[model samples]
Target: MSDLGLDDLAAELADFAPAKKKQATYTAREERIIAGFEDIERFYEEHGRLPQHGEDRDIFERLHAVRLDRLRELEDCRTLLAGLDKHALLDRAAVVSMDEDDLDPDDLMAELSGLGEGDDITTLRHVRSAEEKRAAEEVARRDKCHDFEKFEPLFKQVKDDLANGSRITRPFELKAEIRPGAFFIVFGQICYVAEMGEVFTNPQGRTDARLRVIFDNKTESGMLMRSLQRQLNEDDAGRRITDPAPGPLFADKADDGEAETGTIYVLRSKSDHPVVAEHREVMHKIGVTSGSVEARISGAEKSSTYLLAGVEIVATYKVYGVNCQKLESLMHKVFASAQINLSIPDRFGHMVKPREWFLVPLHVVDEAVERIRDRSILDWVYDPNAGRLVEA
Candidate 1:
């Protein structure tokens, strides 16, 4: 050692360095057999019985039976599972066998690809776990609404309130914003959260609540709070029904569509009449016009919609890709419940009821326009008492 050079000493040290262990790899077939066996083990744990085959049994159980049979036929599979075969499932006789040359090349490639991608080959065969079965049931339960008669009148009242200008829908907010009385649409069914339990941490550490959710068709479910939230967030069609409020529907500036289509305007009459002066805040004239609002209201004293007097524009929403006539009609319908019920004389001295006159708050009109903008107005109706939009 004393006679050795630096390079010789380094070589000796390298020889004592720890050897790097190579990774263990399995052939495609070996990987597939292991995955198949794991599925069987899980199935046994959940069902408390071995998967069986029969025309009356579930297809998934039959597939499991077939998979088990194939695994037992392969000696290599049994050898690989020797340590993991605590259930002695691999001690059975071979039920089926095929030569390597007998399988179609494409079929073999697909099987290998399915294994590598971790796709459960049994999934296509209608094999499902407990969670999967629950999800399927959720999707299929949309049609049943027990005691729907109790909810039918509620729907009717909402339509009346929507027509009367008492309720409006706004964009939904999350969590703290969603309370016990809120409504939502998930998986295409309108759901109402009748009550909420205390907020608590879920298994994933996210905040959750216990909710009693009533569906539109009369069915109800007591689901975890965030469970509904998760469904809403993950489902493409999930939407919350904004709580109705007494303020403007939307306080934002007019959108770009106003330039192309027309403006949906909320107006308060400047008439000093006792009726108009008393209910000033509640009474409004909601209308749509393709032309300038200022110019349109220039001869306010001559028209019945303006209450035969000059009017102040309280709010205006620019609409795009809309039929102004149809929009005006919709607005008129929304406030029909709150109609002023007064007759005004035109320049010709003919008295006529001002159809556009509504006793709704200015903010309600604004929110209604927002619903129209989002194309959700058609699916919602106002609930005057609840002060929110409910599913139509």
Candidate 2:
């Protein structure tokens, strides 16, 4: 097609108005057909040959046939455009006119001839290859489930010790499974338990929590947990904890509504603890929550020591299609500069549980312990108020 003729056709196509009722019905597929013809014309101009028939047959028949097919397929579209009142046509035409530069007559004709649609065309071969790499990584992670069973005895031992009142030594670490669950123990009685949700306490008396461990029945996570709970209950007769009861631990309380079982665990410092005062200050600065917070203090062994403190608080969050990578990245940055050592299992330490929880351990020396004594982390550890971290 001549450039001027193609331009005139494009202008006509652009001006072709769709009826209000039919405008919403125009599918992407239909638009692709329109765009395909435009591309075919462009291809012909570039190579000096029609796409399908090439220079063998007269170009007019090929062009006419394609246009006729498009017109038939777009009969409803054309009717809709024609039926539009003058004002509506002018309004729609203004927008379509702007897209005139995007039209390709060759592509449009190709779509009409049932060769190909312009919208279906993709040149991102590399993007598809990259997606394959990510898929492979996910498969590896799934297959590499470390043997958590071996740590069972150690967990029992630590739980027993904690039950008997042990002053967990500083910088101590061990991997164990505590009968009902598996956990990484650090600094004696202190343990980092990866349950159904993410919970952490800081040395300066702060807490941070996320939707990792806890389930919200009303939420998508809650539904998955409920299903998993049912499957687990069916798989093991003795392992079932409850008959999928709705509680705060498993679901969030409705707005302005109370939960049948309270899930929120609030940590408060004791009066005698000096860290309590510091915790209150930190809490004010970074909004304390029973769900999320971690505090750290350094400079204990030196006489001229400086108190270094940091807290991992969840600032803002968004749920995007079952992926918790964003939340994990946020938690990693929160603890990045804290200088506290987290006791993680060799197998599960680096791995986050499917339920979306984290096991974090906070450490401090004896002298600087005062810096965190009244702090919220200690309050959480020594006297876990409302949450299930410490058994009543």
Each model's Cα RMSD: 27.4, 28.5
lDDT of candidate 1 vs native? 0.59
Q: How far out, in Å, is residue 203 in model 2?
A: 64
Candidate 2 lDDT tens digits, 158-207: 43432221311111121112222422211001122234444455455654
Q: How many clashes show up per model?
A: 12, 48
Encode model 1's per-residue lDDT on 54-138: one tens digit a residue. Answer: 3223333444666676666566677888877777767754222212211212221211111111233322122224433444466
lDDT of 2 at 42: 47
| Top candidate by TM-score | 1
Quantify all predictions' global Cα lDDT against the true fold: 0.59, 0.27
TM-score of each: 0.33, 0.14
Q: What is the lDDT of residue 253 in candidate 2?
A: 22
Alpha-carbon shift of residue 149 in model 1 (angstroms): 47
Over 4 Å off in model 1, which ranges?
A: 1-259, 383-390
| Decoy 2 TM-score against native | 0.14
Candidate 2: C-alpha lDDT: 0.27
